[model samples]
Target: MTVRVDQFPEVQGVVSEPPVQARNLSVGEVLGQVTELVQAKKYDEVQALLQNAMGQHPNNGDLINANGYVLTAMKRQSDALRWYRDALEFSPMGSGIWNNLGTAFKHLKFYNVAIACHQRAIALSNNEAFLHHNLGLCYAEVGQHGEAIMAFDRALALQSDFHLARWDRARSYLHLGNYRKGWADYEVRLVSGQIPARSVSGRQWTGTPYAGSRLLVLAEQGFGDTLWALRYLPRVKGLGGELIVECQPALCSLVASLGVADRVVAKGEPLPEADYYCSFCSLPGLFTPDLSLLPAQPYLSKPAEREAKFEPYLRKGAGCLKVGIVWSGSVTFERNAERAISLERLLQSVDFPGVQLYSLQKGSPEQELQGVELRRPIIDLAPELKDFADTAAVVANLDLVIMTDSAVAHLAGGLGVPVWILLGHSAHWLWLLDRADSPWYPSARLFRPRIEGDWDHVLDNLAIELMKLATVKVPLSSVG
Candidate 1:
């Protein structure tokens, strides 16, 4: 656990036992070819090449470092650590090795150690922008957004065109409620090519008058993002002659009902000719970075037939405070572990007097409730819910929705249903920082954990809030 390189001063004494030999290629020449193979993603080839070189020059710092670099790229962080330790012995002053060593610790989630290593690397080589970027990411992991921003600023100052740094810097800003600055840097995602920017190969809409031409508004990112951004379509409707919306098939039915677009089409369907294309998530930056351009909630209505289809199940909890809950989001999301709460923990919030809890969770997470005993009976609606449309119909009947941050939060909030969002210490930037309410969804009340992944405390606080509501009946019109 002693990460400070100074603790291992003996590393400077001796290295690689009794291997005095030479190779045709010098260590620098071997590193050049190793760099090429690494750039080509031939990690195994780089390892093989390094192994051969290390046999001839066993104590060489560059060879040891190259082995560690390729292993880190291969995601063998633990294995990489050994090579990094060996590299540090021969070249303790190597800033590149220090940076690589920091990354290995980072992959292992030894963040404080990684931060110290990055700082050491920066001390030796201050001009490396990516070293500062790595340091900022470690800071962001622990909810130090202000420090993260400063590190990102230093990275950007060193390399202004570093889109990766800018994109993360923007997220830090967005998390801090600096929407204007956040939105400006957020546009770098288009050129960063990190996350896919869903757009057509036509003119990009830039908030100009769209009176004469067709504008295709494409949905991007997760279902929660689309659900949140759909509220902005009405504002876009007024700016165009024909506003065509292309979204995932699960959302087409719901998006069509909003009537904001001239045409609603599922993604990957037949092409709709348009003069311009824009991303639904990008609407804010084009119109206004701040929250002023948002249209009213409940822009989408429950389809009457869908509502009727779900009424029999919804009516089961007639005299109780019907509450819907979604404990998790898509598993494929990189940050799902942070945003998602366990169903066992989430149920604690709904266990108040006279409150009926219903599970609105879909996907494999519904399996968690299969054999579980509960203090209060929770109606399982997962099998009955088909898509966003089906879920919206069920949410329309709920007195409230209490769940972790997920698509259901947005679904309920967009429908103007009262929703209490359980947030992580630092995950979704849309919720902003240190606030109990969201400007994007007036109906949403946010809650964050006192400590990382401490859902029990957050839910306990939420239970107190829900207990107050249990004493008073939720008005019918307040939801649907």
Candidate 2:
């Protein structure tokens, strides 16, 4: 990733004179040009340049490392590993090469090994900001938020304007439940250009009372995030403004049920001019929410009418503890694989007696059920679900909802349903660090992997908990 390819260790055994076609460009100069091409995402052109450079400087560490970085950018981490190792052989003491190797390992989910590799890189070249930033990322991935924050501090210390480090450090702070600093640091994302640049037509709201004015609250980020932040609309409504909430069409009905917003508009719908506007994610920062002071739950009501409309579907099963499960969240989320678990693994723990299971899972993962055998039959509810409203309606009939960190968790939690959130050891900031229950959702219990990246413990503990529920807890009167 670094453009300084040959300054470190002198890139020994390379000819000082350039090849004729390169127009007298030295090896370092050619590789420096290669970096620009890589950044432009001209992968094929980058390959051609690297190939020619490798031919001229056969043992150049920078050329080998650049090959690795390009392969990584091309979504070929496995291939990148081979090139990184080759680079390390020639430039064993090259810190940047070591950093690239660590990055490849990080992509492959070998966090501990990647951590060590990054540390080695730092030991060799302590002044590089990115090396510390990469190390911090691995630490955060493993749920060591404090250590990650320290690493991020070192990165920022080395390079004060390192936007990515600031953004990542904010995540670490939020995960540790330090809203004071986290919320402030989180604003760095806007400055880092991680999101599309916005052009606001009016003044930005900063949680001020708009007494006689209309204030727009636009939903941003993932659906799950919007769902989680919906709890704050009531507070904003309390500010005496005519509130408007704009969201994706799929959530229009569910969001409207809150009735806090004077108007709930779907994206692309005709919009009303507002005096001021604020982002949904930005609300938490403005309030600096105290975890212990979470507002009352059931912020969203389960539409009793939809429950009646779907009554015939569950009529045949009258006397069982109805449970719903969602195995995956939005696939586009960068950390989807970390929060999501295999449906098969969850089934191992959820097949307890007196419980009727329903598959609330949606999207491509539904294909996982095609060849799966069931010792106990489960109804697939996802086929009937048309939107968040339908999901909430079905949720009304269930005594319990067990799911990974998906929007369903937020939906059920907001509805005051008894929900269990299955989390990766490295869960999101909302779950906080070392908690069995959530301050945001009083009825929700969190189950985390005892060891990082291993779901065996989570399943084992969940099975025992389910056994207790099956034998000891009374089935909810509504469900049974």
Candidate 3:
């Protein structure tokens, strides 16, 4: 579609329409065609259409803003910022342009600039619920949960049906240790498209008596989350019903060994008949609303053969503390950049005298150990580590396990091993806030950075604690 540039005025506010076209078509019709192409994943066609539109209507804010949208969709966020700036020049007071610019800045991790842009959008149009939601996201990125929650509340107050805002508020609440409201609000995950609702025709298990029936517990979220939620499975079994746990492939063997379920099935496989179904995470809300009510103990055990296989690797020097260490988790995890520490940094910061450090790190992060000068010895056991079952055997043989927040921490805690977990300033919701201990893992101790991103201080504190452990004497038989 072609537009006549001289026929359109420089519209202010939101730029509701593009410049008039010579082809006898409204700019909205051309934009609608572009939107259809974008939705169909024809990005090349959308880009050509947007470029053509912008060339014809050089001063049109709508065309420029649409170009920004297309660029952002293409993951060219830096280029998107340029187009957004050009759109703002044509319609300086447009709240939509300001909001779009803020979102683009957020993608580039310029959170402070994103916050300023969102606030400016709010100043121009105070009732825009999405602007408040965007502002809340910026606050949450900076670890300002209070401001984030307030912004989310404002967004919710303006638009009660804003499930995404409610979902984010729930995360903020959980991060601050307000589990009572957080779990209830967490149900909005289904509505917000964070979790797809299963097509189970049976009733959801709600902690009610179900004598002699079968319950199917569906797994959701990460590996650590599944391990943490397994603590409630035995309770479900005790309610006078057989349990069938649907879990990820990596966790099927581990979960089956726990003896909490009558049958363990991997997710996406055909399921056996059951009377009811429930999400693994929803169990905590039903059974342990109060943190004190959680049954935190050694609920998992390693197979005898697996334990026997690693027995030779458990040998330690006289009077030395054997400690297993994990410096990283899944690289694809969103918060891994903040949670993971480099092997070089970990080696330089802590000195464990009379201690044997065993590496439990796996995947791509394990590659960090190559060509690094080690201040102390760390036995590389990662190459032989096949799965969680193998990792559990290694933990069972250790006197202590020190690691960052990962599934290994969950494995150690579930096996009742003594573990010290290093956490970032704004750690996961499971760790909660400002605590050295966890209600979910009675045997686990936590060390958190006093300041954000200050791993040196956290490692220094851990080193001091390790010194105390080194002075003590414990029998190898009682290590597990």
Candidate 3 lDDT over residue span 320-382, tens digit each:
788888889899997798899988788754445677778889889988778665555677888
TM-score attained by model 2: 0.88
- Report the C-alpha lDDT of model 2 over 1-480, residue by residue, as the tens digit: 343323221111122323235544566776666655655678898688788778888998778887877787776989988998999888999887777778788888898998998899889984778778889999998888899999999989998988888999999999988988998888887777776665555688988888999898886777788888898889999989688999888898988887788999897777778889888888888875557666777788876667876676565446767889888888888789888888888888998777778888999988887877875678887878898999899887788999999989989998889999999977888898889998888889999887767788887888888887774455598574
Residue 151 miss distance in model 3 (angstroms): 2.7
Q: Tell me the whole-model lDDT of each prediction, alpha carbons only.
A: 0.78, 0.81, 0.79
State which candidate, 1 or 2, has the greater TM-score: 2
Better of 2 and 3 by TM-score: 2
Worst 10 residues of 3 by lDDT: 4-13
What overall lDDT, based on C-alpha atoms, would model 1 receive against the true structure?
0.78
Q: What TM-scores do the predictions have?
A: 0.84, 0.88, 0.83
Native-to-model Cα distance after best TM-score fit, residue 71 in candidate 2, in Å = 2.2
Give, for candidate 1, the lowest lDDT window spanning 10 residues: 1-10
RMSD of each: 7.2, 5.3, 6.6
**Angstrom error at residue 268, model 3:** 2.8
lDDT of 1 by residue, 1-480 (tens): 111121121011112222223456666667666645755677777677678888889998878877776676666889988998898898898877787787788767687898898889889874677778888988887778899999999999998998888998999998887888998899887787755754455698887788988988887777888987787787788875888998888998888887678888897787577888888778877766667756666666776678887777777778778899888888888778878877877766677767778998888888888766875678998888777898888898789998888888888988889999888876688887778998888888988887666777888889888888785556799987
> What lDDT is obtained when candidate 3 is compared to the true structure?
0.79
